[model samples]
Each structure stands twice: as C-alpha cells, then as structure tokens.
Target chain A: MARVAIQHEDFDLSNEIAELRRHDKRVGAVCSFVGTVRGREEGTHGPPVLSMELEHYPGMTEKAIEAMIDEALHRFDIFGVRIIHRVGLLAPGDQIVLVAVTSAHRGQSYQACEFLMDYLKTQAPFWKKERTPQGEQWVDARVSDDAAAARWGIPGGNG
Target chain B: MKIAVRYFASIREAIGQGGETVETRAETLAALRDELIARGEPHAGALARGKSVRMAIDQVMSDEAAALREGAEVAFFPPVTGG
Candidate 1:
C-alpha cells in the first residue's frame, strides 16, 4: 500500500490497518486516529451541515504529508505510517481523515500518531467548504490546531 | 526574471484564474507580490498587504523573504484548514 493517499471514496479502517502491519512482526503497537464530519456547527443553532466540499492543492498536499511522515520517522522509532485524506463532497457523520502508526511499543506509536495529526492539521494544504441551511461557507482555521502543533515545537500558522 | 504565479481558494476566486506567467524584476516573493499589487484592480484588491495571504514557492510553503529564481512557481492563498 502507498504511504499516503488522497481520494474521494471512504476508506475501510480495518483493511488499511491490516495492510500497514502486514508481515511486520516487529510492530507490537498500533495507534490510529479518525476525524469525522460534525452534523452541527459550533456555537450556532443554525441548520446542520448537509455536506462538506474538501479542496486541496493536489501536488502540494501529497508532498506535505510525505514530509510530515518523514519527520515522524526521524523523531520516533516507528515501523510504519499511513495517512488517508478524502476530498470532494462528503456528508455529515462521514469519515474525513485517518492517520495510523505502528511501532515496537505503544509509546512511540501513540506519540507519532498524534504528532502526524497535529502536523497535518496545521501544515497540510487543504480547505473545507460546508453546505448548511445558512448557505455555503468556507470553514475557518482554528487557533486550537496551531496550539496543538506548537506543543511539538513546530509553528503552525495554518490556523 | 519571469515567474509563474498561482492562486488558490478565495484568492483564486477573486483573480478568476488559477495561474499565470509574468515578467518581473522582483527578486523575492514579497517583491513579486508588490509587483502584482502595483497592477491595480483585482491584483491590488486580492493581494493587498493587510490581507491574510499565505505563499508557497515551488510547491513548498514559504515565507515572503524567500528568494525567487527564474521560472519558479509561486502560489498565494488564505491560511489552510485541513486534517
């Protein structure tokens, strides 16, 4: 399996994890994260999000994620990493992203997993536009995501 | 030097095109931006100094101070929101 994928189709978590760990007996721990679309917008009682349209800078998106994985490999003793991000139109409750990591122990896997996610949130070049009862709106970047990435000493200005 | 300028997201929407080739004497990303802004109208409005614009040089995220070379591809857009 490729280390990174950007597709419009929903992914099967079990299948992806299996493909990542296949024949890697040295991997004793696996950590994964899945981000899903929320039905409601925060702080607004407005109508639910009917669908979300994800847009990205194609070549740059893949390159950025690959660089993040390379950084994780340099910082941790992980055995494998897989990241999948979906684009195009998606409905509420649909999965949006997945980051999975494997290592000889849980410590490295867990930290690396979070590190990749935090990095992706701030550094990756992707945008989200939501269709709501209020009409179509582009989602704004969050300061919290920058803070999350800052914990790892990386400056995250995407927010 | 000649360079390729690209726009994305809101900036793309404002500029009405994804990319273009331009002839410029600007030696840095910031200077190139200023050159475009000097063109007036859409370029001025979309790339005004106060606007929150992010840039990438040769497909890698870069700051304004980054040096520009001939035939480099530079992109301007708003801050990214991805997971």
Candidate 2:
C-alpha cells in the first residue's frame, strides 16, 4: 500500500488503520486525525458554503508528502504511516483528509500524528477553493497554522 | 538557463495559464521572478512583490535565495490552504 494517497475517492478509516497494524506484532498504539469540510469556516454567521473544490500539483504533491512521512519516521519511533487526502469537488460535512500512525508506544504515535498534520497544513502543495452563495473564493492560509509547524522546529511559514 | 515554470491556485487563474518554458539569465529564484514580472501584464499583477507567493524547485519547498538550474522545474503559488 502507498504511504501517501491523493485522490478523489473517499477513504475508509477502519480499513486503513487496520492495515497499518495488521502484520506488525510490535504495534501497540494507533493515532489518527480526520479533517472535514464545514458550512462556514470563519464564523457561524459567515456565508454558508455550497461546496469545496480542491486543486493540487500532481507530481509535487505526492513527492512532498512522501518526504514528510520519511521525516516523521526518522523523528518518531513509529511502525507505519498512512495519509489520504481527497481532491476535486466535495460538499459540506464530507471527509477531506486522514492521517494515521502506529507505534510501539502511545506518545510517539500521538506526537508524530500532530507533526505530520502541521507539516501538511503549510508545506503540502494543495489549494482549496470554496463555493458559497456569493461565489467561489479561494481559502486563505492562516498565521496560526504557520505557528503550529514552527512549534515542531520545522520552517514552513508560507503565509 | 532554461526552466519550466508552473503556477497554481489563484496565481494560475490570474496568469491565465498553467505553465511555460522560460529562457532567462536569472541566477536565482528571486531574479527569475523579477524577470517574469518585468514582462508586464498578467505576470506583474499576479506575482508582484509582497504578494505572499510561495515557491518550489524540483518539487521541494524553496525560498527566493535558491539558485536556478538548467532544466529545473519551478512552481509559484499562493500559500497553501489544504488540511
């Protein structure tokens, strides 16, 4: 199985997690994160979102994610990692991303999961454009996300 | 040197094209950007200075200081927003 996947199809969390720890006897912990599209991003009173269209640099997207997974493995004592990100058109409440890690202990997997997510937020070459009643608008990168990656001693401030 | 340049997201839309091959005397990424901006029109407006543009070379995140190489693949885009 590929450690990183960028596709238009939805992923099954249970199946992915199970596959991560399947043949590994040393696996003692599993940690995962899921991201979803919401009706409003800024505030509850913000314009209701109709859908989200995602764009990615095909060759670079896969290469960048694979490199980060290698970084995660080097930094943490993790047994496996699986990341899936959906692209194309998606509606509110639809699943958007998944990051899962397995390790011999809970702490490593937990930390690695967050680290990978932070890295993905800023470093990955994916763009999100939202459709609302007003029209389509590209989502802007947040400063907070930059700070999140910096906390891990990673330099990924693209904002 | 000649390089393949790619643009994404809003930058791609603003530039009105996805990519192009440029023949330039630029020694660095910053210089290459300036050369493009000097072309005027769509490039100057879309990739103007202080536009919060991000760059990559050979599929790796890079800064303006990165040196240019022949046959390199360079990309420009706004800051990423995907989760």
Ten residues in sequence with the least summed lDDT for candidate 1 chain B: B5-14
Candidate 1: stretches off by over 4 Å: none
Residues B1-83 of candidate 2 have per-residue lDDT tens digits of 88999999999999999999999999999999999999998999999997999999998999999999999999999999888
- How do the predictions measure up, each by TM-score? 0.96, 0.98
What TM-score does structure 2 among the candidates reach? 0.98
Q: What are the lDDT scores of the predictions, listed in order?
A: 0.92, 0.95
Q: Model 2: number of clashes?
A: 0
Which segments of model 2 are wrong by more than 4 Å? none
Evaluate residue A130 in candidate 1 and report its C-alpha lDDT on the 0 to 100 scale. Answer: 90
- DockQ for each model: 0.78, 0.88
Top candidate when judged by lDDT against the true structure: 2
lDDT per residue as tens, model 2, A38-143 = 9897778899999999999999999999999999999999989999999999999999999999999999999999999999999999999999999999998989
